[model samples]
Target: MHVLPERIKSLRNVKGQSQKELGQALGKSREAISKYELGEREPDPDALVLFSKHFNVSSDYMLGITDHIENKAFGKRKPYSPELYAFEKYLKNQDFIPYLQLAVSMKDSHLDINSFKNPINKLIKQGKKQKHPK
Candidate 1:
């Protein structure tokens, strides 16, 4: 699948936003948003900028140039700590599907990291056993 359409659709779904709502926010018609997500039409440069700003993501991410979402250069958020940045870099190098699934599960459950300890440890043990069979 083309990265742009999939990214747009996924972000919208994750945000629980309808195409009409997104279009209204971006000052485009709902049809335009639908077209953009369907890959039948492309957002102009200005609309693309609006999307990046609206979603607080980098334009490069919206355009599929990078997988990192935050528009560090455009936003006013505090700088990422060195350790946090390192962790994020490491995650970027790993397979993303599992992380995405974990994120969705966490969001749905409203659970904190502490709540995942047992499951995580079980997975770790399973991995070790698989690597060093009896």
Candidate 2:
């Protein structure tokens, strides 16, 4: 669906920016910005990265994966760097079990959208009080 333009405009309004001002931050001409906001043309991946960081939104949010920005996924994660390419190649060569294991390990290292145990959703340490005064 063509949800990006609408959401982008909404985000711009939230930031109190004019199209030209937003374009400057995003390193685009005002006309290009207008076209993107009008849904005349979609932003390319590079521009999408810039938009995500500039707007403090996620690529998923911009792409309309979920309506709530809180559900957004972050990370530029460009798979073009030598390290990234190597990892990508390694992933392509991996068996499913290894991949699953690596993902589980990653959960210990970084929080993710589908990770139920992400600390953001965790209960902090506070003594539980008895409901009926046991």
Candidate 3:
């Protein structure tokens, strides 16, 4: 399946948009849109992000990882959640990418909560030690 091309075309059709119209909306060229739908080129990250946002679809769906258009697994995310808000602030304070990688790795690992406790506590201790060494 030519996922990107097909998906782009399908989404454009659903939105009742011509390639030229989509290009105008996205500040791109009609030729660019044609190339994307023809699978002659792939969209850059920014363009992909734009498309996902504009269509209210997941990047996974746009990339063909999932058939579902909306990410139902995320359960209709609100604009804000207390825990996520706090976590985002925490990430902003810390080295975001490394912590993001760690979080993703842990989530992907599916370890038991008990199993995670020791590693998490060790990281906390390390942060404290770095903050103030005796």
Candidate 4:
């Protein structure tokens, strides 16, 4: 039950979805979704089923029975990568969503990570200054 709230929030953030977006997709209101994440309310069995289907995760995982979010019935799920997970957290913490979107858009456009070096450096400097102002 505790894990249900955490998993819901984690999955939503990982998918870059706001509560309103997820609620609309699931036919629930944004406030309901908020309550679910806040642990103020628990979803019914029907809502649980919808969540599993929408997130491609198993209900057992959502219930904290498993650490993996795999749904074998759907197909062989890809294993989670710790590095990718860490990078995702880093991006969220650093508020890099816009830059990440820009980087993703540049993909297959004959650009490399090197193309973002200057911007990345500037962002890092800004973060440092914000953390420790003179």
RMSD of each: 13.9, 14.6, 15.6, 10.4
lDDT of each residue in 10-104, candidate 2, tens digit only: 77876778999999998898899899988998899999988877766667777887554531244344323223434554667644455467568
For all predicted structures, in order, the TM-scores are 0.53, 0.51, 0.53, 0.59
Over 4-121, each residue of candidate 4 has an lDDT whose tens digit, in order, gives 9998888888778999999999999999999999999999999999988887788887788877657456675545632365465678964677777777878868689897889888
Best candidate per lDDT, number? 4
Which stretches of model 2 miss by more than 4 angstroms? 71-134
Error of 1 at 65 (Å): 0.8
Alpha carbon deviation, residue 67, candidate 4 (Å): 0.6
**Per-residue lDDT of 82-103 in model 1, one digit per residue for the tens?**
2355466567864555766787
**Residue 126 alpha-carbon offset, candidate 2, angstroms:** 45
Worst 10 residues of 4 by lDDT: 77-86
Kindly provide the TM-score of model 1 when superposed on the true structure, using C-alpha atoms.
0.53
Model 2, residue 134: C-alpha shift (Å): 65
- Cα-based lDDT at residue 94, candidate 4: 46
Q: Summarize candidate 3's per-residue lDDT along 6-67 as a digit string, tens digits.
A: 88887787677899999999999999999999999999999999888776678887898876
